[model samples]
Target: MPNLTITEMNNLKEELKKKGYKLTPQRRAIVDTIIENEGKHLTVEEIYDEVKKDCPEIGLATVYRTILLLEELQIVYKLDLNDGCSRYEMVHKDEIHRHHHLICTKCGSVIEVEGDLLENLEVKIEKQYNFKIKDHSVKFFGICQNCGE
Candidate 1:
C-alpha cells in the first residue's frame, strides 16, 4: 500500500470538483481503500469487502459507481487479466504509459514490471506506419519462480 500525500488527495478532490462531483464519505473510503491496496489489482467485490469494514453502510453499488467515476476521471483504470475478472489499479500521474505486468500462470500472481519496455518498438511502428502512439498495455504470462520451483 502506497501512502497518498495530502497534496495528492487535494488534487484528486479538485479533479472531482472540476467534474461536478463531490468527494463524499463513501467515495473517499473507496479511494482510500484503492490507495491502501496499491498493486493488488482488486476487483469491485474485493473493494467493496474492504471498504465495508470502515464504512459499514456502504453499498456494493456505491463502490461500483465510485470506481466507474474514478475511471472516467483517469484516477484509476481497469485491468483485465483474462481470468474472467476485471481488476483495477490507480493511475500514476508520472507515467506516460501504463507499465507491463508479469502474470504467473500456475499461482495466479501478478508482478508489475517497471519502466517502458517498448519505446523503441513504438518509435519504429510510429515511423513505419506514420501513426501516433498514445498508450499501451502489455502482459506476459508464464510460470513464476515459486511455481517453477
Candidate 2:
C-alpha cells in the first residue's frame, strides 16, 4: 500500500541522475511495475510479465538488469523466502530496519509485519555481545489464519 509518491519519484530520478544512470523508458516501466506491486514481492519474471503488459518490447534480461541496478542503488532489496526464487520489495526510507514477514507454510502466503518486534532482543544482544546492530530480517513460517481455519 505504500506506493511511491510523486516527490519520491522525483527524488529517485535525481538519485539516478547523480549516479550517472538515466531513467529510461524501460527502466521507468520496470520501476512503475515494482511500485504498483509493492507488497507482492515480485520476482524478475513476474516483474517482466507485468511490465510486458505496458511495454511489450521489454525483455526479461532488461528487467533482471534493472532490478540489479535498483538493488545496487539501495532503492530495493531482495527477500529470500527459502523458496528458491528471489523476491524483491521496495526500500522504505523511514524504516530503520527491514520489516519482518509472516509466511504461511501451508498456503505460501506472505504477510508483512510493520512493527519492529526485535528491539528488546536487539538491545540484549548488543549489550551481551558489545556489537552494534544495523539491521535484521526475520521470517516466521507457520499456518496463517485462513489455513488454520
Candidate 3:
C-alpha cells in the first residue's frame, strides 16, 4: 500500500469540491480502503467487506457508487483480469506509467508487473503508424506457479 500524505488527501478533497461533489464520510471511507490496499486490485465486494470493518452501516451500493465516482475522477482505475470480477487500483499520480497484470487463469490470482513493459512497442508503433500512445493495459493469462505444478 502506498503511503498517502496529508497533502495528497487534501488534493483529492479539493478535486471533489471542484467537481461540485462533497466528500462524504462514506466516500472517504471507500477511498481510504483503496489507499490502504493500493496494489491489491480489489473488487467491489472486497472493498465493501473492508469498509464494513470500520463502518458496518456502509452498504454495497454505496461502495459501488463511490467506486464509480472515483473512476470518473481518475483517482482509481478499473481492471478486468478476464476472471469475471472488475478489480480496481489507486491511481498513483507520482508514477509516470501504469503497471501490467499477470493473471492466473486457473487460480484467478492477479499480479502486478511494474515498469513500462510497452515503451519500446509504443515507440515503434508511433514511428510506424504516426500515432502517439498515451497509455496501455496488458493482462497475461497463464497458470500460476502453484497451479502449474
The TM-score values for the models, in the order shown, are: 0.95, 0.93, 0.90
Better of 1 and 3 by TM-score: 1
Which portions of model 2 show Cα errors greater than 4 Å? Answer: 1-4
Q: Which stretches of candidate 1 lie over 4 Å from their true place?
A: 1-3
Task: Point out the higher-scoring one by lDDT: 1 or 3.
Answer: 1
The candidate, 2 or 3, that scores higher on TM-score is 2
- Residue pairs with clashing backbones, model 3: none
Model 3: lDDT of residue 56: 98
Q: Global lDDT for candidate 3?
A: 0.86
- Write one digit per residue (lDDT tens) for candidate 1, span 1-149: 34468899799889999999998988888988998998999999999999999999999999999999999999999999979999999999999999999999899999999999999999999999999999999999999998895
Find the candidate with the highest lDDT and give its number: 1
For residues 1-149, write the lDDT of model 3, one tens digit per residue. Answer: 24358898798889899889988888888888998887788899999999999899999999998899899999999998787889898888876677888888888877788887788889899999999788788889888898985
lDDT of 2 by residue, 1-149 (tens): 23457898798899899889998988888888888898899999999999999899888999999999999999999999978999998899999999999999998999999889999999999999999999999999999999995
Q: Best-fitting candidate, measured by TM-score?
A: 1
Ranking by TM-score: 1, 2, 3
Ranking by lDDT: 1, 2, 3
lDDT winner, 1 or 2: 1
How well does candidate 1 match the true structure in TM-score terms? 0.95
